[model samples]
Target: MSYAANFERMGRGFDLAHAIAEADRCLLCHDAPCSKGCPAETDPGAFIRKLRFKNITGAIRTIKTNNILGGACGVLCPTPRLCEKECSARFQSLARPQGADRPIQIGKIQRFLIEHSWEQGSEVFDKPEPRPAKIAVVGSGPAGLSCAAELARDGYQVTVFEARPEPGGVLRYGVVSYRFDLQFLRREMEDIQALGVNFQCNSAIQGKESAERLLKNGYGAVFLAPGLWAAATLKPTPEDIEGLFSSVVYLAALRDGRLAEMARRIQGRTVAVIGGGSVAMDCIESAVKLGARDVYLIYRRSYRQMPAEPDERIEAQEAGVHFLLLNQPVDYVTTDHNRLQGVKLVRTRLGEPDDSGRRRPEPIAGSTWVLEADVVIEAIGNRAPEESPEWYPHVKVNGQKLIQADPASGKTSAAGIFAGGDIVRGPALVVQAVQDGKVAARAIKAYLDQ
Candidate 1:
């Protein structure tokens, strides 16, 4: 059986009738809280209102005006945490004992309009004539792509330099295919391309000299969005042993079609994945699809505190993946051949709130234990690349090692250079990165106009 065939999209988009019904559910509040909750500030209320009135083209244009990657945002964004969570109907339903009112399916409706326009061969966005000033965008993730699109629309010549063979960055490589199809991403990229933004694939900008060369070559500005490329390790055992792998590397390999070689080596073996975020869930699902006999999702936090969406966790559970909560891996129990064995873990408990507002997990002193594991995948987190400071000597960074820039403008320490997305804010949602790119584009445009 083809593993790709078995993996399905997370949700089917809404049809026209259902999309209008969901749009009608919106109260059309004067000050839409759902729009406020949206990081990309797509103005969900206005679009839904237009959609309700059967103005499909206008609704899509409104959405694209704020979020260049509106289609991908519809599928990838955590709606429950953002727009839906702040819906007035959701609050109203909560206030009333039996109100039965729910937040409008804003994401589904947006997806419907965007996908519908694409299917009908209608215009989804308006383009402007090219200007004289040129802008160079490094990276092809949401941030780089969004920034490039915005700049291109303003008539500024925009060229996105991507390190990978293909663009889309995380949308193509980091995310699991089941969450969103490659065709969906391809369509979104085509929209950006249609806006006159040029994509230079297989072009990696390594250091300050690379950026300086762009400036020397008449590019007025540069936006660095090289995302968090370094994966957090399980100290002292981060090496690529016969069975050890980082979730980031593993997922990228799976996306690049290279995981099959490694997957076949561990067929029917038990796999233990460590983390509590959506990426961990992806790892679990991918391992299952790769024919792993048993998959265990180990997290140091409780279920309620998991960073992943509840629906995602539910899907994993339904797929027969085991959830091992409140467990922290301390050591790798390797075989004498140093090939593969298991992992040693310690029980943990939630403590006082940490800087992130969630309760910190404390490892119990005597709660160490070993679990069976043919392979161990660490999905803890990712870090900024170590060569960043050296790569951009002029830019400043915070103690956390993230780029230091104004949140409002995405302005960096150096003049004519801006930064955003994972490189600046650390690993975050795609919508947030899209907003960063939009903000940075405006700032760059303002600087150029001055």
Candidate 2:
């Protein structure tokens, strides 16, 4: 079975009439709490108002002014937890009938308007002139792209270096294509390119010396937004087994068409995914789509405490993925030939709050069990690449290896150097990284002006 053939988008966008209706539903609150809730500070009120008035180009400009990747983010960002959650209409609806208690569909409307513009072949935003100052951006993920777009708009000669062959880091290589279309991502990159942002793919900037070399070569500033690509440690890593895989590696393979090429290798096999985050949800769903006979999602925490978005879990469940919540993998059960067999698991109970402010999972004694697994995928989390600090020695890193940058500015300890995205904040929302890039662009401009 072709895994790519089975992919489907999670959210259905609004039609033109429905989009207009949704745009009209926005009270266009003066304060615009919805825009404030957005990390990228997208002016939903402005865009929706423009859409309401049938100014399609104006609406697109209003969005791309703040978020260059507005189209992709319209599908990727969890609007209910962010912008829609803060929508005034939500509170206004609470006073109405029960069934009518719904906020304006900000994400869908944005998706419709932006997509409509692209279909029309209309310019999303005006191009900016190139300035004398040259700046280098490491990574082509949301943060790097956002920063590059914003800086290029300011007339800086910006060049983005991507380690992979493709421009989008996680958005292109890690996220499932169904979640965010690769073509849309490339189009957005093209938009940034239109603004004079040059992208150099397969160019890995090694260490601090390499970055220093860029500075020596006369690049005014450097922004590090290379995201977390290293798979996080799974205690008693099942790597010794032949059928085990890391979630990051698995997704990358799937995104790059490698997994589909080898689809026969995993066809009809029982697959178990370990973790509670959105990545795990993607893994299980991918497994099912890849023709896994049985797909199991094993989570150490309860469903309520799962780090994944609520809708993501629902989508996975609807895709025929079985959930084994409150179960933690202890070890692997393999055959004498070193082939994969099963996973040894133990029951877990929620305890007091942990560092993440969620209830910690504690193992229950004497509750060991085994679950059959032809293949096991660990989707727990990702670690920052170790090459980070070594590449920019002047920057400080916390215990987790995340770069120490100002939350508001994305500035590092070293002048003319900044960092953001997963490298600074660990794995976070793409919108948040976009906001970081916007902030970093302003900071870099300020430094250059000084």
User: How much lDDT does each candidate structure score?
Assistant: 0.87, 0.86
In model 1, the Cα lDDT at residue 297 comes to 91
Best by lDDT: 1
lDDT tens per residue, model 1, 1-450: 676565534457898888988888888888889999999999898899898788888998898888988999998888999998888888787667785878888888888888987898777656687689999999999999999999998889999999899999889889887777788888888889988999899998887557656777899999989888788888754674778888878888877877667578557999999998888998998899888999999999899999888999999999999999999988888778787688899999999999989999999999999998998888999888777676667789887679898989999998888999998988898999999999999999999999
Give the TM-scores of the predictions, in the order they appear. 0.94, 0.95
Runs of candidate 1 with Cα error greater than 4 angstroms are 8-11, 94-99
Q: What lDDT is reached at residue 437 by model 2?
A: 97
Per-residue lDDT of model 2, residues 41-75, tens digit only: 88898899889899988998889898988987898
TM-score of 2: 0.95
lDDT of 1: 0.87
| Cα lDDT over the full model 2 | 0.86
